[model samples]
Target: MAILLAPMEGLLDFVLRDILTRVGGVDRCVSEFIRVSNTLLPDQVFIRVVPELLNGGRTFAGVPVAAQLLGSDPVCLAENAARLAALGPHGIDLNFGCPAKTVNRHGGGAALLDEPELLLAIVAAVRRAVPKTMPVSAKMRLGVHDDSRALECALALEGGGASELVVHARTRADAYRPPAYWERIADIRAVVNIPVVANGEIWNVQDALRCREESGCDSLMLGRGMVTNPGLALAIRAAMAGPDASPAPWGNVRPDSSLTTSPALYPIINWQVLLPFIAEFWRLVCARLDRRKQAGRLKQWLNFLRHHHPEAERAYMALRTLSEPAAIGQWLALQ
Candidate 1:
């Protein structure tokens, strides 16, 4: 089974990607979307979203990174993708899955699901735009409003020559809600000749196993789940290879005390083990982002991390109202 990191627009930027990839287990990563519009974007624009482009298209930990493009215009996207190809990403992935209102309002992202013909055109154009050796993949939700055209959309991407397809298993209307339709992904994989990767609601080892079984897919993409628990991929592998084989200090899942916090279902990367990565992430966030945005970034990540680590909850509250970098650093150091 292959595990790829999902592209999250605002949350999973390069800083987090670098840190998470450093923690290990993810096979490949798809960078956050670079929206294409009327004009062909400059190389800097692509690099800005996927700085891994400058690092031989791999994270510092040596994980290959794919550049994902979002747009409604096939010609414009192809032209930009061709330019991005020159920069040497591991691959190019089209974003037909983002449910952001800002992106959908512009007729990009999930809105494209409503037009299967257009999805085919976009993928084909992008596939032809870059070198044939370059893999061009597409990520799509079930549909914009309903999943009625989910299979049609999957077939459209396959017909357009996408080497792989990732089905997020929910329509745009679902909008980050619970209960991803994993079985629907099985339906998609049945028709498409290319490999199908299942994504959505995969939060733990059990969830990952069930998603793979239900979707009939070998590849699973980790999104917010990975952000919440950086060790997820490794835990999934450990569970698959030998449920009892994981080393001490890892796979330290406590019993489930509440239905919402099913802590027993997943491994816990102790706060001590996770501190170095968090420090490095903060360093990168400071170096790459604006002064005003730095503190918010750390807090944002902690908000997710809190779900898995009680330490994160304490850290989040300690830094909740802080905007000063020095104060944030001091707080992190004490952790």
Candidate 2:
């Protein structure tokens, strides 16, 4: 069974992938969707979104990372996939699951699910363009406005030569609402010959188990759940190890003073362990972004963190007023 980290746009960047993968238990990481329109994007664009491509398409911990592309044009997506494959990504993933208004307005993402033929055409074109050795995968919601043709879309992707399929388990109209309908993944799995990965509403080990049981799928793709708890992957790994296994004791682990590699192996720690990471993230992000932009990213991360960690709310409260990354770092240091 594989555990994949979802390519959440505007979040989950290279730095986050590096940090999360280093903690262990992720089989592969999918980069945030690279928006491809009518033209083929430049090499630098793909690299900027998936720097691991330059490092044999693997994170520092040696977990493979696939490059994901989002678009509606079959020829353009195929052209971009070929370009990305030439650069040697571990795999290629097509995105038909994004529900962002702007993306839908432009006929990209979940909008394509409304027209299964176009989705199949886009995937088939890209599959033909890339080397057979490279795995071509597709991600989709249950359907566009409903699940009426959910089975049809999954079959289309499979027929189009997608090596694997990832179902987010919600229709385009559902859009990140309550009740992810993980069981719906079984519907896709029932008809498809390829491996079906279940995604959505999996927040912890118990949720992972339930998702596996309900979806009847061994593999899973995690998105917002990962943002809520960085140690979630390791926890799920432990749970899968044996019936007697349990989550790691984070409180017992020593402080990661270097703020780089942890002294322990795949250590699972409490939310408090995230302090050094928060500081390091601010430092690294600040080096690459302006003050306001860095602050925005910090707030965005904290916003997700608040869902799982109480301390994150206090941190967000204190740091929300500060727009400077240095100030955020200093606040973390004081904490």
Candidate of highest TM-score = 1
Alpha-carbon runs more than 4 Å astray in model 1: 243-268
- Model 2 residue 233 CA deviation (Å) reads 1.1
- Top candidate (lDDT): 1
lDDT digits (tens) for residues 1-335 of candidate 2: 88999988888988778766765667888999999988978999999989898899988777899999999889999999999999999999999999999999999999988898998899899999999999999999998898988999999999999999999999889998978898889988999999999999899889999999999999999888888787787677767776554434454333222212222234454666777677767776778665667889889889998988888999889988898666777787887
The TM-score between candidate 2 and the true structure equals 0.91
Clashes in model 1: which pairs? none
Residue 223 shift from truth in candidate 2, angstroms: 0.7
* Model 1 lDDT tens row, 45-139: 99999999999998887889999999999999999999999999999999999998988999999999999999999999999999999999999
